[model samples]
Target: MFLPTTVEEVERLGWKELDVILVTGDAYVDHPSFGVALIGHYLLSKGYRVGVIAQPDWHSGEDITRLGRPRLFFGISGGNVDSMVANYTASMKKRKTDDYSPGGIGGKRPDRAVIVYSNLVRRFFPKVPIVLGGLEASLRRFAQYDWWSDTLRKSILLDAKADLLVYGMAEKAVLQIAQTLEKTKDITSCHGIPGTVFWTSQRPENGIELPSFEEISQDKSKYAKATALLQFWTDPYRNVLIYQKQDNRYVVQNPPQLPLEQEELDRLYLLDFERRTHPYYARMGTVPALEMIQFSITAVRGCYGMCSFCALTHHQTTHVLSRSIDSIIEEAKMLTKHPDFRGTISDVGGPTANMYNSKCQRRETQGQCKKFCLHPAVCENAKVTHEDYLELLEKVKSVEGVKHLFVSSGIRHDLILMDKDADRIIKKLVDFTPGQLKLAPEHAHPKVLKLMRKPPAELFLEFKRRFESLSKTLSKKRYVIGYFIVAHPGESMHENDYLKKFIQRNLGYHPQQIQIFTPSPGTLSTAMYYTGIDPITGEEVFVERSLKHRNKMKQNVNTNG
Candidate 1:
């Protein structure tokens, strides 16, 4: 059973033999599809006692420690820490906020709460094994460039003092870790688990070492490609040899599984919820903002959009699999039944909102398409249709108690505007949409859009006009939130100047939430950012996002008044 995060409450629950205690910073609300709720529920079904600590202000070390140290394992993730950092840095410049200052917990510093929690755990129970997981740890799995600090840094595990780092989908590895820990308390005994990186006293002095390049690489070309790719991988430290015990070597492995069938996706969502009605509600107080209605739901995992700058496609393996409509409805029903139910659903979409039910057309023939579609030109044989996604939206909207269903995820404007069914979806959105639609055109410049592998700006403008026309006809107020990227490699000052004018003329000088391009690990843009050259071709390039350039852009906006 899962208990809320309170010592007395946990004791009263009498789940001391609980096989695992999953500690997370994300909320217990399953809507947004953060990993904690799913993993915690999965553990409970396996008969493990579980508890959730949602967004505990890590500043109070006591708050984290007070959860009653259990004979269990901890799971942690900060939603999307890398993106959060990038967003924070960009926001700070515009707001003139000192949040990222040395004294502030902002900037590229490890999440303060996560840092404090780790220190507190070590201080209180030094021997208890601590494993770090989530985007924060995973993307920084190797030494990569840190845009803020402008230097390469080692893996977050080494910096955070975590005993192990679990990268990629942690379902299997987390289960194995819990079962193994329940049987024994030794860290060294866990060296054999797949999808985990660990360090032990008995291991080689440098820790569990990965296999050398020669052993893992089949050819010199592959090694050269990896080495070249590594140069542009940005973090805060230099790359070091980190071994994966599963494959018995240091090389990166293919991501685990990409569930394609609806049943598999449903099983992933049908995880057990063991928390009783009372304690679960009571623990809500411990969370800073625990509104049940503010939960998010991921309709799809993995994005085929394959934006050059996005790490999601690479990390998630770019196979767009969606939760079944019935599964989505079921989860929505559960969210509405919560005592504090609000009429609105916070977010209902994944990497891209409109791409629900999207899949490869060649799935039946190719078994599964492993390679990402990374062309500037849209695929002529695009398999997923707009009709399929509209059906999903209709089903989701029909769920009882769902007053407002919103799409907080990015929209693939290319697909939405190109397809005839997409026109219906947009019209439906204007008529039936709860209120807002967030779309990411990424850039307005043709050359930059080409590099980002995004739809043409003209297409987005046309879609915007059509959406506006629909909104006017329906007598509904609707607006599109545009997303743009700045400081991409090869983006010139002249280009940004033109972009600013374009936003002023088109998006109306409202500061269109521009993001400074930070090269995360394992993206084409990252490769370009690091080497000052494109990885696919040996051509030289200029990487943008210098501190001066960021300041200049901000100044331009401020002065534009």
Candidate 2:
């Protein structure tokens, strides 16, 4: 069931007021895939009255005050995506569509939604505790580059003046917070808690101080140094408090919360989610984001692929936690009962589709595992297997009413090569993907791939050779389509030019769509873009800053292969 979005609905619940309220930038979708719905369901299961205020008008206080003040706290998020990314394309052109908004319209939410919503709430309910969660807050927990503004900005916590910031999967941390606030009524005294950050007057004696905000702004190396510390300190077992300064106080981030174990992961997916948008949005029109993911089942919560351009590191763990095969089957069975399910499952996957049922075993050592899991080479200790996934798919394919099951999320090429039964897995995967398999090569140059911490470009060529041979032998009509990032850090203009020619000569066609590099906050790539240096080696790298030049690079991919 959808959470109460109006005061009358709250009254219909036979309650005086809600215990928690979630304000988001997206339209209300009460599906487990949507963050607000997942959070609300978790709180409800814990016996707290939860309500949601979604896509409220920031101009006036009417929508903000409609739900009234919650008794405990108000949770804020910029929906599933950062607002700036949703509002604009990488080419700095305005976008006209938003998957999360009603009627697929843009401009439903402000550009910097987290700050705007927090300040709007403060206007009427100055004393209520305001908590920030979701992608925008998690990635911006520390001050980093902001692409939209083209400058380094302070942490989102400082700008929004929130009471607390929860990073990564917030289920475990949020429950602890609810209990603490209920008992102590002290947000400040609630320290040493995992998966959270709060403002402190003085730095803790045990904390690791990042290069002060001023020093990072003055020197590029300092930013890289701070990022190195940030990435290393995210390990929950071997972590120390990390802090950076604002004007007068410091933002203290506690050690990351321990990842949920298998059984725990099972319970989260087993929760009662309506798995669709609230009926109110039906009047406005269907939500594009919900419709796309409604038939999809997420089997994992984290990734080990530490791509510098991706923010999964900040929002999740290197270790993957997948739902049991039985649990996944249960969800598939549930979908079969839904009226809208048309016998085709859009996807059965997560972050990196094949990083399932494995561990790096780096925990055996008592320090952070600093090496990239797939770059250079796959770690020897890393357990790579496809038995679980392959067997699970076979069983899911046999389920009644399942006409076709497609693994839309791309299985990493490197992982496919690592599996023991590569030929069988590759043949079946090729058979399953409807037309083309999405491969994120990012770039075809060795230096660029190193900066990305991805496998060498040669790996893609090898994988393509095997894939085509298998497709021919299996008599399947399948092809490989590449996802390339244009103007990435460490890439000279000549290299990007080479990429276009390389695809044409080898792949025999030009890519129709090209993803332009945008320096989003909290990504190491963004750090590299701002500092003009590699984060790991602290060596200067070439960055294309000219908008005209970058657009030309995008056009090169479009106009030619």
Candidate 3:
């Protein structure tokens, strides 16, 4: 069932006030893919009256007060991305479109939306417990670097004046907060909860101390050092509490919550989701973001690849948790019944599509992994197989009214090479995909690939050759659509030229999906961007800071041969 949004809807449910209210920058979509919807529906299963305020007018209190006041707390999210990153381009210009907004509207959400929404809620209900979640809060739980302002900023909790911030996937933590607050009615005492960050009058003595806001703002090396330490402690099995002073109070981030086991993951996906945008936005126009994921299924979460530029490692951990096949099939069947279902399922994959039903050994989770799962070379301890995923796809195909199923998220080329029986997955996808299987090679140059923590250039080359041979055997037409990020740290004009030449020699064509790197918080690449040095080696690196040069790097990939 959809969460109650309007006061009339709440009244119709025979409710006086909501237990929790979620304020989001994007229009509310009642699908498992959207974080707010998953959490809202999950709360409903726990018997809480949850309401959502989607992209409310930040300038006024009209929409913010539509659902009265929440009894437990106000949950705020900057949608699926960091607001500044979402609203602005890498060159610091406003973006013309926001897929998450209704009608693909831009400027619907203000800059730093979590901070804005939390402060707005405070103006109306001064005593309400303000909580932050989603990418903005998760990545900025500690002191972070702000690309928009080109300055280091304090933890988002201090800027937002929020009582608490829950990072990572917050399903388990949100439930704990609701139950604990319902009983104690004291938000300040909400500490020792996993995956939560809160302001404390007394500094948390047991937690590891990081470079303070002032220190990070003053020294680049300090920021780099802090970023490495912060990432090191992300593993739930070996993390200690982290404390960093933002202002007068300390922001204490509790150790990350453990990944939900397979059964628990299945249950979360099996929750009753309406699987569409809240009807309140239906008349405005289509939400472009939904078009990408309305039919797609996220069969897994987290990534073990641990690329330096990617945030999955820092925010979601690199354990590569996944859902059960039964749960995925049931969801796919439900989609056939969806009103918009065209007898096709857009995707059934995750951070890495092939990683589904495969995971690290028991000892791999005891602490942080010492090596990347697919970088340099596939780790010896890594489990590489695709039999279970192939079986799941077969079950999905057998579902009545399902005409087509595609793994559109991405197919890791390196993983494809690692799997001894990679031909089956490639053959199936070549037949399923119209012309291409999406792959993120990121860069073709070795130095840039080293900075990216991705596999070497030879892997993509080998995968391409194998793909050609397999497709020739079937007499089918398909190729890899490579995604590249240019102007990354350690990548100057020299690497861009190298990338241009590498693509010309190997693929015989320039890629279309190319972009300049944006130094976002909670990424090792961003740390490198800020420090102008490799965090691990402390060696100077080339960082492209000029807008003109960065723009040139983007164009290098689009010039077809």
Off by over 4 Å in 2: 364-368
Q: Per-residue error at 205 for model 2, in Å?
A: 1.3
TM-score, per-candidate, Cα-based: 0.78, 0.97, 0.97
RMSD of each: 6.5, 1.5, 1.5
| Full-model lDDT for every candidate | 0.59, 0.85, 0.85
Q: List the residue pairs that clash in candidate 2.
A: none
Cα lDDT tens digits for candidate 1, 1-561: 344566666679775544455554444544224466667676666777777665555545665666666676666665434434523455334222222121222322234334445666677667777777777666666544555565544556555676776766666777778888778876556666666665433334352233243432333233224534432221112223334322222323222333336775676665544322234433433322333224556678766676778777545545566787788888778767766667677667777777677655564234333333535555665556667667776777778887777666677776776675666778877744556676777777776776676777888788888887888887888977787777777778777776777778887646547667756655667656766655555566666656788667645643474
After superposition on all CA atoms, how large is the RMSD of candidate 1? 6.5
How close to the true structure is residue 363 of candidate 1, measured as C-alpha lDDT? 42
Candidate 3 yields a Cα-based lDDT of 0.85
Q: Could you give candidate 2's per-residue lDDT for residues 1-561 as a string of tens digits?
A: 679999999999898999899999999998888888888888888889999999999999999999998988899999898988989988888899999998999989999899999999988899988889999999999888788887778999999988999988898888887888899887765566899989878877877889878888888789888888898877787767899886678988999888887887777777887777787675788899887788888888788788999988879767677889998888889889887889988888888778777666675334348787777888777676787887778788888988888888857888888877888888878867878888988888788888998888778888888888899888887888888998889877788877878787778877865788888778889889988888788888999888888888878866642
Task: For candidate 2, give the lDDT of residue 214.
Answer: 87
Model 2 compared with the native: what TM-score?
0.97
**How close to the true structure is residue 302 of candidate 1, measured as C-alpha lDDT?**
67
Candidate 3 RMSD to the real structure: 1.5
